[model samples]
Target chain A: MTSSIHPTVRLTSQQRLEGIWNKRTYTIVRLIGEGARGSIYLARIGNRYVALKISQDSSVISAEVNVLKEFKKVQGPPLGPLLLDVDDAYISHDLKLAFYVMEYIDGVPVSDWVKREGLSWLFPISFQLLKKLHKIHQLGYIYGDLKPDNILIDRKTKQARLVDVGGVTALGRAIREYTTWFDRGYWRLGDRRADVTYDLFAFAVCLLSLDPHVTIHNTKERDIYKVLNQAKSLKPLTPILKKALSGQYNNALELKSELGVINRKQLQPTKSNRKTATNPKIDFWPEALGLSSIILVHAGLFYFLFYRI
Target chain B: MHTGTIRQILLITDGCSNQGEDPIKVSSMIAQKGIAVNVIGVLDDDQTEEPVGLSEVNDIANSGNGISRIVYADVLSETVQTVTRQAMTQTIQGFVSKELSQIFGQETNEEDLPPETRGEVQKVVEDLGETVNLQVLILVDTSASMQHKMEAVKDAIDDFILSLQARTGDHYYSIYQFPARNQVVKELLPWTNDGKRVNKVFPKLAAGGITPTGAALKQTVKAFQNVPSSEEWRDDSDDIIDSSYGSSY
Candidate 1:
């Protein structure tokens, strides 16, 4: 029986991988990210480094590879890591693992970026992420697992990019992967069906999760709403998020437009309101107004990205 | 892509079968009818030694032509969804592999295909996986050893059904537990799409009985055939479960 095979592939430090199918060789650098389905390793294919995902289940490798392929067909900005290679390798005499290599984006996850840069970045980051989600949703797929780990912020350009398409399910199909915190079913708010709204719902949760104060317990609907409402950093966008969480927006486009309106509305008040900002009673308002100038630039970028698609 | 529906019997248990018939044999018979019998061997977190039923779980899956997983109770819901999706893709790959054999005039597995062709085949398989009608018969081992694990089992089933709503394919789910008070198997909830029906039945689930896995599996095969109640199981199936429970939310 194959029961004794380890759930994950553990290799010696700087292990070398020679593919059986493609006759390609790669040297491992280190483990990058580990998911429920597989562990991703940063590896050197030749002189260049690529992200390699190895799994015991060949179908998982195949499904994700296909998603990356689908990403290439989308007409806009790159959706995820580029698919480079797909092959199988022998870990032991009896154990063969299916692996696919992709172009590695050297960036921090969005959560880390938000923590480092502060709450103002949330608007621009969400704008970029919603654009990507809208593109994929147009192809009748939902980014089923839309947590922060799956979205990476480029170190130099500070642009948001999506990674890990393992949970990309067809819009109507059962969601194959999800995190408990981002899942609407776990919150007892909505069903787990893959749809445009499902990703939007998760997008709302993903945004909420950036706030260090917001933690969702596995019980009570009113308590979750209370916690989300009380978050100071997320207060301005709370109404938009609430609409998304309640499945008010029909598609990512509708959600994107609503978000665009908020950014614009946030921008209008900044110029006139800057003079009276030093008052102790309105300290929070000044900080919120400060984010508007950044939101204006991002709002323009959002339009460029929107029509170029 | 295979156009017909995919049928699966997901058997979840923590220990070995103690009475009635050989589960491996029953699984093989079920496999012969083109229904895969996937098994998940649930284990408690602190347990050290391997459970007695671990090998039996592998044997059943092997003979039944399905995937088998042994996971801790904490991750049961995730494993349940993964195994189900894996089984669907595996089944489709199997058919695609056979068709490839005819075209190439040699035995060729889908994985053995060149990477480009494999990607195309995988896309087809994934598309088919979404659209193909799926019917899963969930078999839970409700022996005394599994008493503490019932909460995890209940959550897993609920999660599984809720997850299925994302699929475009029509799904029919039914729950069957082994070793009812008198009989080998009892129907907790008949085939239904509403996951809420499971909430009603878990309250009635009392875990104190022998593990008649083989007999339970035999009854599962009969249930898949749409046989209402065979003579021996008819009397006990009526006592606790109301017929209305299957169809109602």
Candidate 2:
């Protein structure tokens, strides 16, 4: 369905959209972000806030709507922004625009959350994000563009919600969209297929980016590997990062389990007393027995020599 | 930020640099940061004044340590695949030679090895090629004079991507068309593996406006500068690297 609106048309605040399914009118409060394919807006329906995504390109909007509808059908824990309603509006005599409404996630991006709330939150946040991804993977879909911007973290709820569902691709399909930094293809580690391991690799990079000490940039492959390997904050995650970077993981759940283990190990207190208790004792009987055995062996050797002489 | 792997900027234009920073200087600076800049000059028939851009293209490619090819529009598809693959092969060979020198006591070039050894090395190189991430930022000139060449460019890009996919499954491509209707250079497609995605933007790529080759080059460099951070991580359960290392030992 081509929108009557020109592909370059931009929506302004206070613009109203009536849902085709529910017939609920949503007022666009403000523009959230604009990308090449579409624009996301903060919309208000009565007193409740919802995210209104409007795009001139029908295919882009259709892909997002299809994925959202599929997720809604599965009815599991919310993996991303919930799809509220979708409709097409006539902007002009010759132009029509497609729009969709989703649950508005009021939170900061993962990167900002880390900077504000401290890196300690990354462990729990990462675990939550992984669980979400596992759910999506179980449903046979992959969050193709798994990046800090696409992920929003609720500080109080401690839930990381995936935004921009346009990039989500079905398992085994070529990933439709991706940021070069998070893409294994960009790193030359693997193909751009929507598999569980793809998300796991991006998740590893996400954790690596959380470290203030580690600055991620586009460089030579060797340099990137070196940076990942030498990242001080990622030292504990080095083995995991290397595997993920090399496309070793089966799914996000496996990564989550390992991350949990690492986090728990780091959080546990060191046992100094136990270490001291395991020290060798100064028992004289064993020492004497050892010495006596050595003397007896020497005596046997002497006797053999004397007999030979 | 350092994008791990060799970053390649492939600028395919049919006109000269008319605005902003000199393409050669921009490419030189990019080269200094270990990025390779390659240029493909698409020439049209009946315009034989040796488009001034050809000299700048050669200089830019030379400065960036990449190959420069000037081909007529009709042969662009085949030549594009060849030029890009050649550049990629050169990069892989350079990396392999460096790695070999580091691992062994002697410095050896890929060509110097015997046939059997070379085959093994080639296999390793191909394997490495799959893992070594590559970003190809294609800058296409979409000026009015170049209108007839867009389809050919699209076909060439399609073929190029297919050949690349066969050689190494890991490759991300982004296309930026210059003298864009609204912007100096519009992103026809973001970094993606799916070539069909470009079809959406190709039909709408009207050839008009001035060819701001220099400004587009400057903008292309800026786009490369904005490398986003990766948020994904790997699972720790399987220590593939460790197991491989142990087996080797």
Query: Each candidate: what lDDT?
Result: 0.77, 0.67
Q: With candidate 2 superimposed using the best TM-score fit, by how many Å does residue B230's alpha carbon deviate from the native?
A: 42
Show model 1 residue runs off by greater than 4 Å.
A1-7, A20-22, A90-97, A217-227, A230-232, A260-309, B18-22, B48-56, B194-196, B227-249
**lDDT tens per residue, model 1, A6-58:** 34567655888889988899898999887767788999976898999997667
Per-prediction DockQ comes to 0.37, 0.02
Best candidate per TM-score, number?
1
Decoy 1 TM-score against native: 0.80
TM-score per model for chain B alone? 0.87, 0.77
DockQ, computed on Cα atoms, for candidate 1: 0.37
Per-residue lDDT over B100-199 for candidate 2, one digit per residue giving the tens place of the 0 to 100 score: 6767658875444433344466555544444555668888888887888888788667656654564334567788888877788888887777766766
CAPRI quality of model 2: incorrect
- Per candidate, native contacts kept equal 0.57, 0.00
Model 1 agreement with the true structure over B89-146: per-residue lDDT tens digits: 7776776666678788889877677667777887777777787767789999988989
DockQ of 2: 0.02
Under the 3 Å rule for N, CA and C atoms, how many clashes does model 2 have?
35
- lDDT (10s digit) by residue, model 2, range A106-125: 88888887666555566667
Model 1, residue A81: C-alpha shift (Å): 0.9
Q: Give all candidate RMSDs, comma-separated.
A: 8.8, 24.5
